[model samples]
Target: MAAEIRTFTCLTDNFGYLIHDPATKATASVDAPEAGPIIRALEREGWTLTDILITHHHGDHVGGVAELKQRYGCRVVAPHDKSTKIANVDLRVVNADVIKVGSLLARVVETPGHTLDHVSYVFDAEKVVFAADTLFSIGCGRVFEGNYPMMWDSLLKLRALPDDFRLYCGHEYTASNVKFALTVEPDNPALKARAEEVARLRAENKPTVPTLLGDEKKANVFLRADEPSVAARLHMKGADPAQIFGELRERKNKS
Candidate 1:
């Protein structure tokens, strides 16, 4: 029942994860933005990659698939919709598909806001979710191929997860996200406190990921779009929650 989650930085602000289960000596790599760094992480961890769990077809998310598969001979599991782009995809799974890695079971959640094919892997046993780009520490992914309402629906699915679930997103943009969040929810006390904390963490050169779901519910504008406080701050009365979330997301992009 032993497990470890390792985070690696890649390509400016992208994050890649290496998840290992010690009970069966099995490992899974999530959204490897690059091959070399993931390889280095695997070697340093003394874990052999048994599977590669991809969330989408974006280059940053699937760029290392070809090389890693050739090198580790690991099964590449990705969303069924993007099988064409993922190299040597051995298992094409859809929403709710459950895959096993040692004692850990990963349940696939179809979170298609960042992209129509985007997915999130939920490790239910550990109460954590590899949220790719759909959900971030203080922000959410840009609506690349989806609309405001659609993205809102996608986020709603994630909001139901346990409040304690640790969310490991696909990028390192917490510091920047907090800045924009302040502009949108300037009066939010929780957001103000979080912005200060993020500043300190960045100043110290520390990681700001693996943020809890509860904190996001309080500080992330996307999650708070429905709160009267958030809607009031946006200067729109009785605004559609999804529209508010989308506007906040747009602001973050240009932040």
Candidate 2:
């Protein structure tokens, strides 16, 4: 059976996602941004938390793990690098690890950019990915712990996924990301249209996430560094894609 996904705002712009598989009555929280919202979400849905999946050790992502574990006895799964720092981690995973949440399965893909230990989860059967901070709607995470080359390779791993996959990132930064993206590729029709749509959504206080990978491939400047048009627009035509990506990341940092 297909998983049922519920997304809600947590701690300002962070998003918390709950995936439930009715077949096995298994429920998983993608990230515990905070305890109140997650606990409330579980109560409202009448679903018991069977698992808590951590994308990284960022406080905003794992801050509520202890509380949730105490409340639901949920098993905590996190990346191996910083698993020790995250409280109550029952399973430490690495790249290519497959985790089972009852009848649902998620494939872990280590993506080191925002943090060297960051990982994204992909549910192949559902064509959905919990990308956390690695890849966003119109932007990618800042290269804090890793270099541009590392971030670029990590992004390529995600960009290579099936175009139809749906991406659920860590934050609601699409409005700002689109603004920065326009500065990089102003003449891109797809981006311009998406910006307008994002503006409309934000105007109505709507969430602008769970964006389609196909749409991102066309509009996200960070993901388009390998495209000739994006490179040419930056006056870096014929430059290596990784170099273009590095320059873009540098510019975004100052933006």
Name the runs in model 1 displaced over 4 angstroms: 82-84
Give the alpha carbon lDDT tens digit for every residue of 32-77 in model 2: 9999999899899999999999999999999999999999999999
Candidate 2: stretches off by over 4 Å = none
Model 1, residue 120: displacement in angstroms? 0.2
* Candidate 1, 80-167: lDDT as tens digits: 8853477789998899999998778999999987888889999988989998888888888989887888888888888889899999
C-alpha local distance difference test of each model: 0.87, 0.93
Name every residue pair that clashes in candidate 2: none
Candidates in order, TM-scores: namely 0.96, 0.98
